[model samples]
Target: MINAINLNSKLEIQAEAFIRFYYEETKKSAQQYKERLSEVAAEIRETGTYTHTKQELTFGAKVAWRNSAKCIGRLFWDSLEVFDERSAKTEEEIAAALLRHIEHATNGGRIRPTLTAFAPQKPEGSDIRIWNHQLIRYAGYRTPDGVVGDPASVELTEAIQRLGWTGQGTKYDVLPLVVQIGSRKPKWFPIPGEAVMEVKFEHPDIEELAGLGLQWYAVPILSDMALNVGGVRYTAAPFNGWYMGTEIGARNLADADRYDELPAIADLLDLDRSTNTTLWKDRALLELNSAVIHSFKTNGVSIVDHHTAAEQFMRFMKREQEQGRDVNARWSWLIPPMSPAATPVWHRNDLTEREIDPDYAPQERPY
Candidate 1:
């Protein structure tokens, strides 16, 4: 139990933080937000909360990406393109906007980090949300033999099927977008082929490995989170960053619960798996990572390896410090899972875990 008074008090605190950050980041005259704050205070007194203006929403989206402590790619946070779609009130409108998001984010193979903040959830209105973890993700199916698709997406895939959509049951099939507006039943929209840009991975050392049929999308657009600007929560804000090579090579493709390609890769490399000292998994992982890097680079796709990503993060921290701002970071997330110790972020103790406002928050899975 929470009471209305307590909730409003918390909202006031969040409002202050967002307004202060907005003024600082945009260098807007303090009087502007002061006047806006008075209006927000009045609104809260009547309705328990207030909404953000288009300008505030845009800047808040960018700063939220900047405050994502777990991201090693925060160096380009300021470059995020923000789309304000707060007026979108229908499932059809949202789905159309999402398609535009996919195409703009794909950027004809050069992915751009983008965020589209839709209408915020209101006390009297239902939330507008995208049920999928991402706007573009491969489908997963649980078959009698075993899982036939991305194991991570099995639950979502089943839910989509139940809603009257079908997949080709292929490993690389792009799932349809599920849009839920207010209290309406969720609707499915097929993503156009031109909106998705996938890169087929091939190893420079092992050219024959290309025949294995492994590939991944260029951008990682996470759509299943709430974007909290001040105390106002936008439930349908989707955002993305250019993928790091390790995210595709080591985690998505190599994680045991996901694609789980390590064993197959080790067999192809002919590494002895009998002894723990042989480090067959490590050898195979390095090859896979190398292949991902080489493939993305050859295709002119924007990607960063763990080492370079860490180095860029360091530069971001320095720049923030020069601007009299402290960098908040979650060490566990800032360091890549594949080679943690080899990166500079692993040895650093200066990182802080302080929570910041205008940030994206993980929400419960809709399915």
Candidate 2:
């Protein structure tokens, strides 16, 4: 059985201690990956465009960008483990025990590198603010439900503990865990001797900016190295990841606008005339499909003949280029629905029935 408990004082203390241990381990791991860190930083400075610059860097942007690399490094040394105990023990004591075990596993019984202490804040009213550098910005929150399972709960609790201290009345607080795994996305490792914890948090509107439906949203799109020409890599500009959205289309348009000198390349790649409503949507879907296929192929799990398929795609693009025609791919209108009940068969917003009448029966209603 899974239990959900509000973090009390003792539990908070245990969480803080566990976070301290995590940070110490993370800092050490970061130090070890200093070379990789430098490379990633240099890559960003050289390749990344200035989305917003006002004489200095903003904390939010810095955190968003650098945290990805920092976490990759942290994963090399630290791992999360959950402990499931059937013994009769208070939640606080269990949390404390988990912290002790984490400490033991992390530093061989000694805390070396100290953690950066952070105080969680509970904002008042509907106008919630998050800090960017020293400036506060308004953000909305949408509470998401937790996955229904035992392991998920364990993961959730451990994740909460890993994020330092939590303040009373704070909602949507996340504990940032850093790991060094050389990848942008976080990889899940199974916790030995325990079920993973199920956790839920308020989903942010920023996620919608990813553009690939609500559920498929993820940040800082993963790279497609297979499509790289030399050391130069191409990715969907706005979202960076393979997923398509309005923002990504906007970026493509922006790139096309920069094709004044390379008109031939522009025509070859269908950069020009790609902004047409139907054409752009089609291209987005194809690019998205390519990205997905490439990811699966790279992971060595795809059934498709990746090398031959990639060669075919490249040849198609080349043929289009030769003919001075833009390589515009069409997207299918038939996007699969997320679930059976996800669709609305009909809608009458006004004077709508609030509940399904069980006594009325299904056959009683007109089909």
The prediction achieving the highest lDDT against the true structure is: 1
lDDT of 1 at 42: 77
Candidate 2 residue 80 Cα shift, in angstroms, is 23
RMSD of model 1 against the true structure: 3.7
Error of 2 at 302 (Å): 6.5
Residues 237-350 of candidate 1 have per-residue lDDT tens digits of 999999888999999999989999888888888889888699998998999999999999899888989999989998998899898888889888888978889888888766
**TM-scores of the candidates in the order shown:** 0.94, 0.18
Clashing pairs in 1: none
Return the top candidate by TM-score.
Answer: 1
Candidate 2, superposed: residue stretches over 4 Å from native: 1-268, 273-278, 302-367
**How does each model score on lDDT?**
0.86, 0.24
